[model samples]
Target: MSSPGDLPDAEVVPKKRWRIPWIWVVPAVAVLIGIWLAVQTVLEKGPTVTISFKTGEGLEAGKTKIKFKDVEIGIVKSVVLSKDYTRVVATAELTRDTANMLVDDTRFWVVRPRVAGGSVSGIGTLLSGAYIGMDIGRGKDARRDYTGLETPPVFASDVPGRQFVLRAADLGSVDVGTPIYFRRLQVGQVTAFELDKDGSGVTLHVFINSPYDRYVNADSRFWQASGLDVTLSTDGLKVNTQSLVSMLIGGLAFETPAASLSWAQAPANTTFTLFQTRSEALRVHEHIVETYVFNFTGSVRGLAVGAPVEFRGIPIGEVAAINTRFDPVTRQISIPVEVKLYPERFTSRFESGPKKGRLTNDPKALANFLVANGLRAQLRTGSLLTGQLYVALEFFPDAKKASIDWSRTPPEMPTTPSGLASLQDSINRIMTRIDKLPIEQLTASAQQTLDNTSALMQNLNTQVVPQATNTLAAARAALEAAHSTLLPGSGLQQDTTEAIRELTRTAASFRSLADYLQEHPEALLRGKPEDKK
Candidate 1:
């Protein structure tokens, strides 16, 4: 019991005591409250996630946070290198509630910065250092670690696209990230490029979006859209320079308005065949044997390995390889071009059998077909500006047939084929020859011909016409005198009347004689002495 100021006593409880001093109790209670708070924080385990990237420039282990729509979900726990050493692995921790929200497809990209397609993104993240952007999908799974995707946010909702691997000869300074356009609209991009193993070709990796991919096919032709487009006009050709971006990076466009086939959706990582536009004329057949070797022993300055080898306006093969071999005995350098041909390209239309079971690559069968149809190989000009020669297969009904022996020395190739190049050269030669022709002598001869014609016409007009006119005048005078003497009408008498009747009978006889002479010019040559009546 404890006593107040008065002597009265109050009920006394036991003096309660803490195991420790009161001063220590205050700190002990505080320690318990702190422990309880730490436990509560530990129990609320946030979502756990991971992301892979090439670099971790602005990302930090403890500082970097991952958020979804500004709501903080998780924090990056650790940064480590993957086993492959090709990527950076970032471990993250999230709240329990947010942890179940991460689905397999949930994206955790490091939102730093990016610049492309004429747009700059993620500039806000630059100031905030680097943050893990968490696109948490709805899911119901216990908290676990996830191996994030290697690629960036390639939105599936965005127009799905296909990839095209184009092999071009002269991509000349074409860089990665080049835009591929269709009718001036950017439809794709050149993602990557590398020289082929042989260094003879360049393989270009191109990606095109959804419907744009459907436009290309086996026969679609592609050309570099660079420099300026030219159009012929009355004021000469007008050149319209394209955009600077298109000129530097150099884009590619295709046009093929033929039959449309089913769209082929080539999956990612699938390899599609690439063909060079310049080498499209080259035909290769694995099963076809070497048939005829044609010798083109002439200057091949502009010829290349992939040069067009045409026959009768048809592309039969390409110049696979070219070499100059000196014939020691003849002391002449001859160019030998090895050409690869696809005999299967020539189909036998004259097959009498079923279409499906028709004979294929039969030389004799095809030769007979050609014999009846008449086939010939003429030099065709490939490029007039470049003077490139290509063989063209043609049919000439009036051309003489020439036999070819495989063992004999081949004939010299024509200087120029009947191609555009040959036509240009022929025109030039004709102009040169005309300039050197003897024009003075031709002018003299023409003048002499004109003078002779004029003289002949003058002789017929003056001498011949006057003689005929005089004969006619004299005959008329004689007729008038005879008529006056014969008809004395009222001036003469009975003798004038008798003479007039005789004169009329004589005139009728003379008219009959003139008619007979006019009908027979050749009869004049069969001359007979005139009898005096």
Candidate 2:
């Protein structure tokens, strides 16, 4: 008010000024920033989903991360029990990148330390902590709520391969992810397996990847390659498939026949039989025309199913099975071995070479033929190391001549124990002979000799030895006295020297008398001739 009056000459305008409270200015700016950050966070959040977990063991409210193919795409915002309290529900805020990942086919699981298919995996979770693992999928419809898998799949759902079913005797050794090998190279794995429909065996579902699957054809063979295949044969010890990894993890192998004419490739879902060994898969098995039961009294410890039945060093059949039967009447146990003989094994040979006569199959004719040739069934050791025994057919002229025992259903053939049983018999005989020997008499004689020796020793020690000792002591004293006397001019030494001279003269006189008596015929009744003169 004083400014306009004071400035009389000059027209002065009041200066305009503006001021704000500095204390509240900073607070207003901070509030704007906070609002903006919240809006940005809301916009960036892709989706919210509820995941049900069997357990909430390794989860933390703000730390458990959700990953797809090992890439973190979301984080758990909260972890709590479900309404029913049956499972744990994890609420997650996913990144914008996972918008499409919330699909019907997507899978989620907890990643922790686990052992699957005989292999240890997810061991890193021991240190870094367990997190949620998600696998994305190509799904048409989107889904938010999901259930987590209890166990992880052996293979990813998107893996490219063809599945095949393999039937085997048992599935004890095999497990999921067990390797399937091709020529010892790992090319596939076991996906799943279950008992066969009939429950007689097991069926394994296997998947083989491309490029290697082509090798499996219609004529292909599959066998277990999960253990050491040591063959004890006459050729020598042959170790097959000694891979330590394959043996521990268990595995299967496939091979197509080299000389086979069929090379048809197997299609998807094709069925195949899994054999125990490669040789079993490759053997040529034919129909058995006749079944024979050999009631063997000999030991069949080393004999087993599939033991070869050889005739003249060539395999003509094989043992189908072995069992023990008790004859109540006889009160003895007998091993009944079922055998299958194929005619083709012998026919093929006769067709190719000497066709002098046809080997008849009639039971009576065959029995006569075997009897004429002295053919007998014998148990022979196939492998000494393993003690595996096989049946051998050979001529045994010295065998107890028994005619064909065709009265029984599966006519029992004339049998003999080959070298295996013979050696055992010889040992038994030697043991029996040793048992019968006169050990008692020998022991008695030895004791008598010991007693006689003891008595003689006692006599020598008590009587004869003492007398000899006294005699030795007397001779030693005499020798000492003689030495003392001979040292100087002792009278005893002189007397001894004179006595030796006189004995020498007497000996000379006797010699002369005998000489004179021999020269004279009429001496003494006849005195000596010199004395008579």
Candidate 3:
């Protein structure tokens, strides 16, 4: 090394510029590249978020992707059990481009095959495997922690449509994703439903797509179109349906009445009533309803709550309820039928009639007057085929005197026995009278008469028949003797022939004398005729 230092001094040149050895160059370049990569990574990294799910199913560390509209926006970096182990926590690394998309209302759910709301969805996920689906909410606030949904939304928030709320007595077969039809054409779907807090009804949220949403009006009528609507009315059997799908999966239908076509379009979030059938939804609304009850004492077998109450053949009301009450003191049960009468239905037809004032001004007074005039409610057979019974208000001039019980909560209208019931009563009375008759005594008398008749017949056969037969035989013998006596070849016949000849000779002599006398006197024309003979 000293010799090498002397040699360097001998060749003494200014210290060569300090330079990295070739072997070090490679390491330096690598370090520079590493720093550059780290800086780029730091610049491109986005906010990290944690998502809580019910389970870690179909989720894998660094493999599962979070997608928005089928485009990858983030990835699950790790999946671990939650602190309380009740759920799985997935930490995701999102791209810088999606840093602002993490919103409070943002929704995320695992995409899997599912059938709901009358539709099959996520069929594409079967081959591509399950992934986190996101729906960007229209919220302004940013959030990092999120709870994933168990089910995907029926529709994205950006879908152009109008939402409406429907109130129904029951949910029936309607559910989220149930189709909605307009004029038998599918136009919308149900988004969600909830039971009313009071538990009196159900409230459904429905969305109508853009063009179809415009068809909904303030006076639009909505009714269930699920299953087969088969009506057996006086007109005939009527079958109606929205579609085959509706019959299978259930659906709802809406229509705007012709009279309401000019009405304003319903706004988003409009509330409406859902009826059970199209007929009910489209029926004319009666503003004035009069409630009444009738105490019937007959079989209401075929009568139903919806049975019509008619005046003559015109429907004026419907049965609201049928109940039975027992009078403990009297030990009698009475069937109380509650009816809701649409008096306007009658008044509308008679608006310009002579009794318009009376009908419109004081319906109660008119009802009382009519009742006093023998207008009574009676059950009648509506359809013989179906044996359905309906209430009929008609004049019964011979009915017993009765009056309304106005003091009751729902005024009680007087009722008379139906024609069938009256007939039944008459039959029952006749049966009772027949039952009270002395049938046993009558039967004994009849048996005695039959026995006497049998004895008479036996006597005739034994004694009278034999005597008659003997008498008939004797008569036959007498007839044979007479016939023989009248035979011409017998001895008595010969004697009679001799006697006839003598008588003839005597008659000839008498005739000759008469002829001589007649010739003398020219009398006795008969004697002259004999002489000529």
lDDT of each: 0.62, 0.82, 0.89
In model 3, how large is the Cα lDDT of residue 15? 78
Q: Give the per-residue lDDT of model 1 (tens digit) for 342-399.
A: 5644543336543322245465555546644645555444655555666555666765
Best by TM-score: 3
Show model 3 residue runs off by greater than 4 Å: 1-40, 168-171, 195-202, 230-238, 273-276, 279-284, 327-331, 350-359, 429-533
Task: Tell me, by lDDT, which candidate is best.
Answer: 3
TM-scores, all candidates, are 0.51, 0.57, 0.72
Over 1-533, each residue of candidate 2 has an lDDT whose tens digit, in order, gives: 68776875867889978877799899999999999999998888789888998899888989999887788889999999999999999999899878887899888889999986677878988999998888776687999999997766676767777788999999857888888888788888898888878889999999898778878877778888887877665334788782677778778888887855367678989999999887888776464456677778879888878788999889888898898989999999988888887766665576566332334647568667777678888888887777788888789988877666678767667677778679999999999999999999999999999999999999999999999999999999999987988876799878988999999999999999888778764565855456656
Q: Tens digits of per-residue lDDT for model 3 on 1-533?
A: 36755663346568779877799988999999999999999999988999999999888888899999999999999999998999999999989988778889999999989999778888988888889998988899999999998878878999998999999999999988999999999999998899999999999999999899999999898999999988775334679899999999999999998977988899999999999998889987777788999899778988888788999898989999999989899999999999999877766776566522225576778788889899999998888888888999999998888888899989999999998999999999999999999999999999999999999999999999999999999999999998898898987888999999999999999998887786666645444555775
lDDT of model 3, residue 40: 100
- Alpha-carbon deviation at 237 in model 3, angstroms: 5.3
